[model samples]
Target: MASLDDLPLRADLVGRTPYGAPQLDVPVRLNVNENAFPIADVVADDVVAAVREAIAGVHRYPDREFTELREAFAGYLGHGLDASSIWAANGSNEVLQHVLQAFGGPGRTLLSFSPTYSMYPLLAQGVGSAYVAAPRAADHTLDAATVTAAIEEHDPDVVFLCAPNNPTGTAMGLDVVEAACDAARGMVLVDEAYAEFAHDRSQTALSLLGRHERLLVSRTMSKAFAYAGVRVGYLAADPAVIDALRLVRLPYHLSALTQAAALAALRHAPTMLARVDELRAQRDRIVAELGRMGFSPFPSDANFVLFGGVADPHAAFEGMLADGVLVRDVGIPGTLRVTAGTPEETDAFLASVARLAPSPRP
Candidate 1:
């Protein structure tokens, strides 16, 4: 008998692997770009009360259709989206995986821009699809020409775009997204996990849903709503796409408790939006301070900013960690991405950076 490790594994997975971000135990955690604020005490109590009310029904199976939660999400977004046009999963991450499973497979291709959310390619590979990326311009702007060229060349089965993209924080305009949707031969997925912080109107790819049968918009409550722990996210698309996702997803994928929590959170979305405004103001202040300190962070429409052209980004990352600050080293040479924390946390991070005495590399 051959050893399990020695035996030949799936050929496709030889070098392919799982995805994760760095986790560090630090006081001021600015990594992962999570909403720095916790759910308000009153709101949290409401969620707790809702969960307790549903706890008695634990023996019963969850709502396989997740209808109530879907309706709540639609109400929260201020869209008259019907349950038929919405689908929910454990998280937007799972929602993304379901999309890949439904559309991506052997011989198919998944397309996205380089230095994106990082999960796009990983999800594509998980479903046995080839992943391709076209690099964004130096300032992290999506190059319509490059994207158009790639679509013409690969003709991918699915294209993923992260708006106010992670690690870069640049938002794509409506025209650029329309161009990609027009060029796509199969499906176009626009991930809007950070849209609330954008300070601009969301050019939801949903607007193109009718015109382009292949468009899907994925959203999450994790960032804007501060419900990361609840693990609920949704996708909006045509009914046909929603049906396909439902078919692929596990029945009862979202727990009854999760549904209740999500609904409660949605009811308070206006309050959450007010909190988002505070976070955005803090983010702007941090970005401006960084510029004054000689760090060139790209103009961001998201909660985090990516600064680069440093002499040693990793070193800076380590230094910040040592000073009790935690951020992500996204491996874009000379660039470190930091999430905007509370005002005090922001000041602490700035002070730590000042202590590093960083000098820009020419």
Candidate 2:
């Protein structure tokens, strides 16, 4: 037998590590930007009933094409999209991976903004594509000129824009997004995972789909519908793009149980919208309180805030953890991201921050 140490591994995966969000057992958890609320009891009961109905046919394979769920999702969006233009996966994360796989590979490049979603880089690597980034301005906004210049220079095959981006919570303007889509020689993926919580209605790149054959808008149930554990996400694009994803995805990739649960949640979207509004209000309150306490919290349109400009971010993070509050210490040097939780959780977190406040030192 050959020695295990002598075996070769995929060269691209060498020295690459798995990606993850922090998991810590602490009170007042606010690390992940999960919907701070859970499914309402009425909605839960409906989902349970639907799942039970689905289980009655457990012996049969689920719809390999997920036609029913896709139609239901399209109806919920009411964005004038049809089933032919929609596709689903376990989560929006998977949807992103599928898009990268379909469009990216050797001799290709994936372009995005820096200090954005960390997963973009990992996804690019997974698809054997070179990843590149253009830094956001100090105000956390994209500079279209710089991005256009980079596109001209590198001529990447895919571009990813996370509206109301993760960690930083900054959203790109429509003009910036449109320009990026126009400049890209290949596909442009706009991730709207947090769009439901933004101040304005989601500016879906779907509107540009007619003119731009390479535009895809990705959305999720995890953040808005509080269905993270259920793991249902979908993408809206041109029928051709959706067909390409269907070609590569595993048949029956979406389980019957997930389909049923997602349908139930979509049926109760109004209730979910109410919860999102409440969380948005809570996030605003928390940001205001943090400001009052002398912390420079960035303006946010998502359910979390990225506050920094502090002298010792790690110390502040540790202090919060010591006080039994858990927030994300995004290693951006002197920055921390905190998800908006319930009123009680918010109070506890703010109290912890107050305790850490003192003579601010550089």
Candidate 3:
């Protein structure tokens, strides 16, 4: 068998690994930040009917523009957003990729804070853009001054701000977005994939859109919408931004069935989100219990908690896995991330952690 060395490949990607978390066959799986609840039966039935209707027309090409999906997304977002300002793709990851493809290329640069979504740098690399990571505060927080300073120093072509950030689950304030826009000479993309799970929705960067034409807020249905299986992610930005993305996205990228399923789920947005409160409660339980047990849990505005003070993250991960629960070891020293799923799943994870107590204090 010829190794990769024999085949011509992009030099930057020579030794890089694919982005993923372990998908083990564990009884209680809370590794990814997925919604713990399943879609409501009513919504599921609607989706089935929609898909059935859509399959009849699958012989024809899907709407290249995904007109209805964009409109549906606009209605769901509803902060004065319209279809002209919306863009959808397989997932938020793809949406971000589209942004980078249009704005970032060789010689251009992409910048973000450290310990953010692990995929940001990969997205930059896929576009042949240089990726620069600035450190966040000791507490994993990013203030306006820190962001502005980095923007000044790096002078990147694109800046990514992940709100309710992954791994740490720290939510950035709107002020940070405003300051970034004020300082950055390039486009600013705020990844709000977990916005719906935020403790306070008002802190969203969407409010800054009208004033800052260069600011774009991206969201995903995979998290709070409980529509991960459908693989629909969209963004709200200036109509011009949406227009730029159209130039790079493939023709008929979203299948008719995907459009149908996503539209059906969006119609019942309230019902689909009914379990958010329950999951939030479970998340709080994890934070409080971890602190009481002597672990340092970061304040999270997302579905997962990134707690520190572990003596050995790998050991805890293995011990938890041995007990039939799966969590994420994000390679952050003395830290691990676990999603807030069903009450039973939460109980199982808590029990495993209790058994693995006597961890090193931070």
Steric overlap count per candidate: 0, 0, 0
User: Which residue pairs does candidate 3 place in steric collision?
Assistant: none
Candidate topping lDDT: 3
lDDT of each: 0.84, 0.85, 0.92
Off by over 4 Å in 1: 1-8, 15-17, 357-362
lDDT of 2 by residue, 1-362 (tens): 88544569687776666887768888778998999898899999999999999999878989988888889888877668788888899999899999988999777899988889999999888888999987888767786786787788889899988888888888677777778876888888888888888888656565666677788989999998998898988998889999889767987888888888888888898987788988988899988887877777888888999987667888888889999898988787767889998898898998888876644434
TM-scores vs. true structure, each candidate: 0.95, 0.94, 0.98
Residue-level lDDT tens digits of model 3 in 295-333: 889999999999988899999999999999999999999
Q: Candidate 2: global Cα-lDDT?
A: 0.85
Q: What lDDT would candidate 3 get against the real structure?
A: 0.92
Candidate 3 vs. true structure, TM-score: 0.98
Q: What lDDT tens digits, residue by residue, belong to model 1 across residues 167-227?
A: 8999888777788888988988889888889877556665666676788888898999998
